[model samples]
Target: MNWTWFHKLGSPKWFFLWSKSYALPLFFLGSVALVVGLIWGLAFTPADYLQGNSFRIIYIHVPVAILAQSCYLGLGFSGLIFLIWQMKIAPIFIQSIAPIGAVMALIALVSGAVWGKPTWGTWWVWDARLTSVLVLFLLYMGIIGLKNALDDVALANKSVAVIGAVGLINLPIIKYSVIWWNTLHQGATFTLTEKPAMAAEMWIPLLISVIGMYCLVASLVLWRMQSIILEREHRSNWVKQEVMNNGF
Candidate 1:
């Protein structure tokens, strides 16, 4: 019924001011949650009957993997918004998120490989899921590379939006890889429709860790977005006034 707040987010001034309210709080909360969850998962939880202590890596691996996929989906959605609505904030979303998504993909890959070492007897593989994920990583890199390589900001944003939009195809492939084909990687850890196969002591910390990671990602994205907004809007009157009065 009310699209007022939605359009308000399109304003760099409003969004930047609004973000200041939550960004630091999220940073502190996310850091605390991540620390507590990692400590609990790594030290307190009992080892898996099958995988033993090695399963502890799951605490980090799964959350980053989830973030990797989820972030791209958000990127694609932002791309759509930019392309259709010509929303100014949309490109800022891509600029802010692309690097973070790439880092998350890298974390997922390295952690997955480490997890694979004991489970699959190798550090890497050409398996479908792994390859698809690598492609996702490249997609993020492509967005970053495309943006940086272009001389024109508008053109760069448009081109990267197309790439980000097209890359949405990989999300489903990465998601269903283990189910679609036989793979060394394990299946879903927890799903809403089905009870988790893990014990409370295990999945509870993992759930907390995932939330923490999301919070951290939000903090980073907002921070980056704020930086971009300031730089892009530096020539605007509000920014000039802010710098003159606030000493920023």
Candidate 2:
């Protein structure tokens, strides 16, 4: 395969065209996966021995939490791509993904609080995992704010790229928070290095949920990136022609 094709991805017009060809199918598949996973996990999965049905919240909460953290790393990687290769699409991707990531982080925090209330007898705690998650949410807000504060797109992108790169220091803290401190939050339920503690009946649905959530996130990000491309390339002839031809 010619590596030169990779450089073509830098063009907004090229990405827009490519996304148009595949977005519909990807969206359909992602939506189906999410719906099936949610139903299976919430209804079909067996209740935990200790937490009972309340543990079902993990189907929603854990996936969003994992994606929230992973999205930040993705944003930082986009920033690195922008800074190193100067790809025009890189900043747009970061911009497009930020709001979705923020919403996911917020959802994770809210769901975690709700779940914590029943299990821990409190809606809020200063535990390491919880606090780090809150900080992650704040970081998302900061990046969004920084992006909007600047009038020039390039300048805004540069500023947020710096912020995204810097904020990555929190990722490890968030991951190890439970272990590093005596937090109420439990350690990881699944790990590559160790066997799963939960039975297959419980873990299978969780795994399905995780995979579904990733697909959902990918679909959303791709859709948003296409929108960003449209907005950024609005004045360009190719975009105008493409929009006119597609009736967009």
Candidate 3:
């Protein structure tokens, strides 16, 4: 089998050239999808019989919550690749993604709290799922703090990679917390094999929002990875020449 393409992913110059073309298009499509989804869900879709407008927060909350967990999964995978294969781009991927994931986790928690207020009668709860999500946010912050504390690039990369890899255990706990314990949080709204629990009017917009969020995250990650590559590879002639030509 051909492993050449996979190996080229390790080259900062190659990745930068490849990703530069994708960032803008992804951002554009993501913005359009997100806007369309939010408007359709908030204004057009009928409100829930029980939760009313408050339930609409699901459009934003579910997608970001999903992304929060997914980003960590990606982070852990990149960390493992870095540790095992010493891929140069893997650590950069981790560094670029950590803060974004942290923000997503924060948004999920806050949106969940806002949605909970009208439905659950409170802003916060010590439910298993909620607590586990909080832990996920803290894990992101910890990785960021750990990276910042170390001045040595190599040491910082190794330390954060180890932490990111070890943090994978939390992902399963977060996913199963609603089932493993009696939690106020509800079960999954949308599943792959089974139909969505909600009406098509509701779930369709949600599906759009999730796809938009994923695209936006991808665009942001690519843009960030490009910047980090420039920062790390600035001493190389390709980086210097590219920067000079592009004026970035």
Candidate 4:
């Protein structure tokens, strides 16, 4: 196969057309998986002996927490792409992903607080894990604010890229927060190197939820990126024609 096709990825029109074909299917599959996972987790999975039904929040909390951090990494990597090759889609991807990551971080923080309230006897803590996650959320907000604060798209992209890159310093902190400090937050319950501490009944649904959340994140990012592409390319003839034909 020729490598020439890779270069064409810079074209917004190509990505727009290609994404349209798969977006609906991805969205549908993500929805089905998320629904099945949530139902199984919330209703079918046995509760933890220690935490009881409150542990069920893990299905949401864990997935969102993982996605929140991973999405920031993604934005940072996209920024690298923008800085290196100057791909037109890179900044759009960063912009599209920021809000989603912020929302995921918020969900994780809230769910963690709720879970903490009953399990730890408190709603908030200054523990390293909690503090680092909060910092990640703030970084996401700063990126979003930078994007909106600038009127020039090019300038906004550069600014946010710099901010996102700087935020990478916190990613390692979030990952090692539990290990580095004695905190209320527990170590990873799931890992590839070791068997899950939880039983199969609980682990399976949690796994499904994690996978489903990833799918949902991908679908949302792609959809949002498409919208960004349309906005940026609105003046282009092809984009105008595509939008008109699609009844947009």
Candidate 5:
């Protein structure tokens, strides 16, 4: 063990420089996968015998839904790192990611509703999974609001970290809501222990789409983190020199 690399990530300047190098490649790969997957799934793959073309929304809905929970998990993990190691980069990641997580949650909800309309015969439902997802969305909003409402930077970061840490409970509930109770929402699309129930035509593109979405989110998070790092470190000489030399 070498932990030196881990600690170096705590440095704002180091992480900013690292992210800049990787973000563009991530965005390019993600965009290509997303476009190809969406096109293949929507036009080429045979529609579900039961759901017909309506099932196409799954290409977008499932990935964002997964991202919603994953982003919060990242937030919570960052909170813990900040609380334990007092890593400066952790709180920056938290602040930079909260709004993006909220947007992901909102997209998941809206896409779910749109998918639900033709399938469930209504735009809304009080089903267990749906309600849990709604709660997850609210939790993200609450974290965002908490961060914005505080006037003190240190206090705000601590408060947001605590909230993000506590919010971990909701993720499991969101995950198991379908199985824990009778619900209109479907069960897991794919899992590690079990083969996907979907045909290869469906799940293959979906898997690609999921990978694409994850890459896209990573790229966006890196871009945002770089911006926030710049803003917070603006008074530092290194950052000033960076701005002057690079106009970034």
Candidate 6:
């Protein structure tokens, strides 16, 4: 198979054009998946025998929680790639993803708290998993802050990448906190090596929600990357022509 396209991603023009073609489709598809998953989970699936209606929140909670961690993982990886290859798009991608990841982290924390009030009878706690996830949110904020604090674009990218890579040390702590210590937070509901703890009726829709959330993240990042590219490439003839053509 041809691998030439991989190197072409280093070109802003190549990425910008391709992203415009795919981003909207991904955004629309994710919206459809989310709507279908929400309806299926909230209206059709049976409530947990124990938690009752509050369990419905999992449709939103699980996917965002997963996305929160996964986004950090992506950030960390993007950091590594930037530090090594110095790819122009690498830092832009990280910059594009950080705010979205932070929002997902916030949603996950709020949703977890909401679910907890019913299940664990508390709105907040200092449990390991909870604490680690909180730190994860802060890390996202730190990356965003670092990016803005620097005056030089190269320095900003380097700072953001370093902070992102360092903060990645928290991902494992968050994932394993349930097993490492006694916490009110539940263990894995879905695992690759084993079937989900919940019935298929419940989990299938949850899985769909996860897929939709991932698509939504991709769409957001792609759109954001385009904006960053245009700003960074403003002096280029391609960007000038594209901007003129778009009347922006």
Off by over 4 Å in 3: 174-179
- Write down the TM-score of every candidate: 0.94, 0.93, 0.96, 0.93, 0.95, 0.93
How far is each candidate from the true structure, as Cα RMSD in Å?
Answer: 1.7, 1.8, 1.4, 1.8, 1.5, 1.8
Residue 139, model 2: Cα distance from true site in angstroms:
0.5
In order, candidate lDDTs are: 0.86, 0.82, 0.89, 0.84, 0.86, 0.85
Rate residue 175 of model 5 by lDDT. 58
lDDT measured at residue 10 in model 5 versus the true structure, 0 to 100: 94
lDDT (tens digit, per residue) of candidate 1 on 23-134: 8999989999999889999999999999989989999998998898889999999888888878888899999999999999999999989988997789997665566678
lDDT of 6 by residue, 1-248 (tens): 89667667767789898778899999999988998999999999998998899999999988998898899999998888788878777898999999999999999889888887987788987665566668788888888888888999889989888877776765676557644665665676679998677999999999999999999899999999999899988899998888788875
Clashing pairs in 6: none
**Per lDDT, what order, best first?**
3, 1, 5, 6, 4, 2
What local lDDT does model 5 show for residue 241? 89
Stretches off by above 4 angstroms in model 1 are 173-184
Q: Which ten residues in a row have the lowest lDDT in candidate 5?
A: 177-186
**Native-to-model Cα distance after best TM-score fit, residue 166 in candidate 4, in Å:** 2.5
Candidate 5, which segments miss by more than 4 Å at Cα?
173-184
Instruction: Score candidate 3 by lDDT.
Output: 0.89
Question: Clashing pairs in model 1?
Answer: none
lDDT, model 4, position 181:
69
lDDT of 4 by residue, 132-170 (tens): 678789889989888999999789988887777766665
Which of the numbered candidates is closest to the native, going by highest TM-score? 3
